[model samples]
Target: MALAIAVGLLLASGTAAADRVPLPALVKAHRGEACVEPLPVIRRDHMKFLMHQRDDTVHEGIRGARHSLVGCIDCHAAKDDAGRWVRIDAPGQFCASCHEYVSVTIDCFGCHAALPTVAFRKTAE
Candidate 1:
């Protein structure tokens, strides 16, 4: 009976660990840019594209939350100094803007660098 209880406890602990949220890795390198920096650049079409990408289970997963919790809008959905839709600094700021109100500590940004520049690549001649 003691052995069975121990096994059950171990199984429960393993299940709990598996339920823990997983964070994505940071964007350390980008298109040959060693010191990849964050930039705010928002495009309507790009936003829509991401919306589609997440909503599409074939590409991501059911509801896409498993693939990425912060769909494009979660970070890129903001207005600029000119009152135009644009990405924000620390893209984590966008997340914190909401999470702070709820007093939630987010570790997602630890491994994942919150930068608007993470999405695209520039081609130079």
Candidate 2:
């Protein structure tokens, strides 16, 4: 009976890992610089898998957070220092720049938004 239970648990665990979309390697590839490609669109089912991995309840609010409506480049792409949108290097500025135009206060930066190099120094840490 114990052997059967262990087998069941192992199968369940394997099924869970198979559901999530692997995060793009590009996001972390450039030394934690912003991703060059659009962030992969993780589906709702995959998000549910992630919440389950965290042992959290699958609430509607949590699911909403999981749905990917846009890719990172949709928000981050901008004119570069070389006068081209494709070459923009500063990524945090990508989000911040738009928020300013929209007249919205960006609180995410208050805790989370430092260039990757300064992320370790964040007070939230």
Candidate 3:
């Protein structure tokens, strides 16, 4: 009877651990290519990289070829059912998905456009 209780408790704990919300599925880039960095690297250090990129652009006027938030928006922006581009904060959108899953507040849209630029939209068209 004690062994049965121990097994039941172990199974319950395992189920609880498995109940964690999984990471959201990221939309493919407009060009259907891989990201600038690997998934694990971006997952761990993307905020650090974005901050550095922001500083360089703001202070030094040197926007690197990659790692800019604008670049990410250009690539990851999604379209609505009506074929109109949607903002990053929209539900199921690229940025919102992961941010919502992790319960993190995103402040980028407060200062920057949440959707891709007109030029980017034209290029995709």
Candidate 4:
């Protein structure tokens, strides 16, 4: 009976550990030391910031490079092993990896481009 109980405990603990799998490492930014804000701040409030920025751009015709989605794609999008530019929604890329880990579905790419705009790309170059 004692041996059976010990085996059950071990199995339960193993299951718990499996349920607590660590999050994948975040992909690196293409420029600078970190994101626009501190890591924790961005992790928590990025959607809020993005929403506000989007409203301003779409309704008010105000555009700011620092907070625009184009800025994000320009800095976060990276080249894959084959030298092709990876989209933000690609697995292990900037946006997809974190969104996948958190189980959040982003619909921004449904209408907006996931890659940076041509003007942004040229300016980056």
Candidate 5:
């Protein structure tokens, strides 16, 4: 009871910024600053772009690089300690970390490969 009161007093005094929860750590994209859209725009509209791209690919039979899931996996997939590529939707991985934090259901990997089929090495600088 005493500990709880102390915590409450600290919070009520504005000493605790209640909204300052740590966000999930995101992996850097392989291409760094070469995303199709700017960071803010992409963070806000990535779902919309993915859905639109899905519609076009499935119904219209059109596939392009601009918003392709393949492109995303290729660019965002990280490596394991053994040098194998990790699935994008796995826990702590690119997709799962954020989606879990935001309470969003991730259904994309249900019918799609979460890791690229081909290997992609970072280019030498």
Candidate 6:
């Protein structure tokens, strides 16, 4: 009876550990210029920045600000091994990986194009 209880406890602990969320696979950003804000600031308040940028663009007739969504797509979008452009919000890609990690369902790509108009050549490693 003691052996059975020990085995049950061990199994329960293992199951609990396995239920923890694993670290997300973040995409490596490839950008020509530095980001609009520091990494820590951007990580904490990016949604607020994006919302403000959208308001300026739609209501104030402003466009192409540093915080614009198009700027983000241009910097974060990547290419596959085949050299074809990959969507920023694709699985394991830039936007999707982080949003999915936090259990957030985003509709940013529903209206916006995921690919950047400017084509970037992968730098030679």
lDDT of each: 0.45, 0.40, 0.82, 0.81, 0.82, 0.85
Each prediction's number of clashing residue pairs: 1, 1, 0, 0, 0, 0
Residue 70 accuracy (lDDT) in model 1: 44
Pull out the clashing pairs in model 6.
Answer: none
> Which scores better on TM-score, 2 or 3?
3
Over 58-79, each residue of candidate 5 has an lDDT whose tens digit, in order, gives 9999986489999898788888
* Candidate achieving higher TM-score, 2 or 6: 6
- Residue 18 alpha-carbon offset, candidate 4, angstroms: 10
Model 4 root mean square deviation, Cα atoms: 3.7
List per-candidate RMSD values in Å. Answer: 16.8, 17.2, 3.6, 3.7, 4.4, 4.7
Residue 20 CA error for candidate 2 (Å)?
A: 37
* Overall local distance difference test of candidate 2: 0.40
| Every model's TM-score | 0.30, 0.25, 0.77, 0.74, 0.76, 0.75
Best by lDDT: 6
- Which candidate achieves the best TM-score against the true structure? 3
Alpha carbon lDDT at 74, candidate 5: 79
* Stretches of candidate 3 exceeding 4 Å from the true structure: 1-21, 119-124
Worst 10 residues of 6 by lDDT: 116-125
Candidate 3 lDDT, 3-120, residue by residue in tens: 9999999999999888975677876667547888898898789998898898889999987457889888888887778888888788888888888888888788999888877545
Native-referenced Cα lDDT, model 6:
0.85
| Candidate 1 TM-score, C-alpha based | 0.30
